[model samples]
Target: MAIFVHLTSAANAARIRRAGLRADSWARTGERGVYCFPVLPSFTVTHQWLRELARRGTRGGGMVAVHLRLDDDEPVLVGHYAGRGKHAARSATAAEAVHRIRELDDPRGWEVFVPRAVTAGEVRRVRAVPQGVGWRYFPGAHGTRPCTCFGCRVRGEYGGRRLRERLPHPLDGPDPKVPVLLERLAAAGEPGDPKEVAEVLYWFARRRRGPVEALIRLTEHPDARIREDLVWAVGGWRSPGVGELLERLAGDPVAEVREAAAQARSDG
Candidate 1:
């Protein structure tokens, strides 16, 4: 089988391990739904993508980029981006692929694999910086100090912590509070940020066994906006019941909700 590597944050890597790739609303134009770059043909491309991520950091903090192995036959949407090579051989064996990746570039980013279920050894602790902060502020940066940029100053003025500590971990299994969280999710107001709901659902889909169930139940929520958010969140999940739910939601009274469900179904 052909080998493919997906580069993502360590937390998202944990999510991928549990439930596979799911394209959430934050995804861009060609990647609006369930999508992933099915190949990382070379380390040069991998480093490029990681540097891009570091350049455009997330709201949470600095992130540890992870490389995950996926086989060609794995069920996923094979999306393309600038980093993917059009002419690269897709039939390369795992060892051959790894060799190609290593030969392509000298490693730079925080690109390491723990390959274990939890923290231990060199995986016990990982260093991370905030959105604007970088290796320059870390201990080994040739004695450079923090940047004097406005973004950095604002971040620090608010008592923001710079270094982030990441635990190397796989997704944790079901918890009792998941159901309660689902209930609160179902009862959430319609006018607030749907992205927040989508984010919560993404995490729940990663760690909980029955988030799909909660989501399915939320489809019956009183507000059309809530229903729309649920449908958008469901697009990220790979499940048997999801197709059925989308089918039902396709006929929803609200045009927006119906359109969201139609797009979600079409994405799969």
Candidate 2:
């Protein structure tokens, strides 16, 4: 079975599992509510989708469908009728779905299909989609649709905070649970998936606060990507000793690491 992801609300995720994707009552006459886009599976893609989900103003938490199956390559579309109408679309790709929607006299009636729920093991923290393993938003259709749904309207709408500022700093407060996150860092040396390890490093590093030895050690990690991310984290801290660390990393053997250090210095 081909697995896909459908990014939506925690509530909507449950609703879809109970009932298959259907037309939104808010949709105009004869319009189907299901939308789907094909996405290449990768860490960057999954990360981007989670970022988009957070931006859409999902306040507390976000949800993603880990396993989804569609009819062949086409996105499943539902119309006012049982499942037959000009509004229903079956394009081989998200881009084609957009093209099909454009051809319609009016495309407002259509909605995207919400995927069925998987076990809780498949779900993850809104901002913390286990590194290389998470759901991806197929950009083909998402790129074209205005998506007035609560999810779309709030995309990239984090008020004053930037999208990257999801986690709290280690020094944020006594009650912010800093020690728990710190323990995650301490446990990084344990054997595990590289992708997952990279994510943990990123989670702490992105906060850019409270320099720790474990984070510095990660800079020497075999994976250039992890090293690059650590450099970014170090650069973000902008503490008294960070400048020296970045200066050393400025000459890192890996071009990516050196480049990342350079960018971080410039940004800092």
How many collisions per candidate? 0, 17
Local accuracy of candidate 2 as per-residue lDDT tens digits, 150-268 = 22233235342432244334343322244665666556654434676666655555353655554556656677777776775567674577777777788899986886687677546
**Candidate with maximal TM-score:** 2
Give each model's whole-structure lDDT.
0.46, 0.48
TM-score of each predicted structure versus truth: 0.32, 0.35
Give Cα distance to truth, residue 100, candidate 2, Å.
28
Which 10 residues in a row give candidate 2 its minimum summed lDDT?
123-132
Q: Cα RMSD (Å) between model 2 and the true structure?
A: 18.5
Best by the lDDT measure:
2
Worst 10-residue stretch by lDDT in candidate 1? Answer: 113-122
lDDT by residue (143-220, candidate 1, tens digit) is 654443323322222322242112212332333366676665656655434655665665454331344654676676
- lDDT score of residue 21 within candidate 1: 47
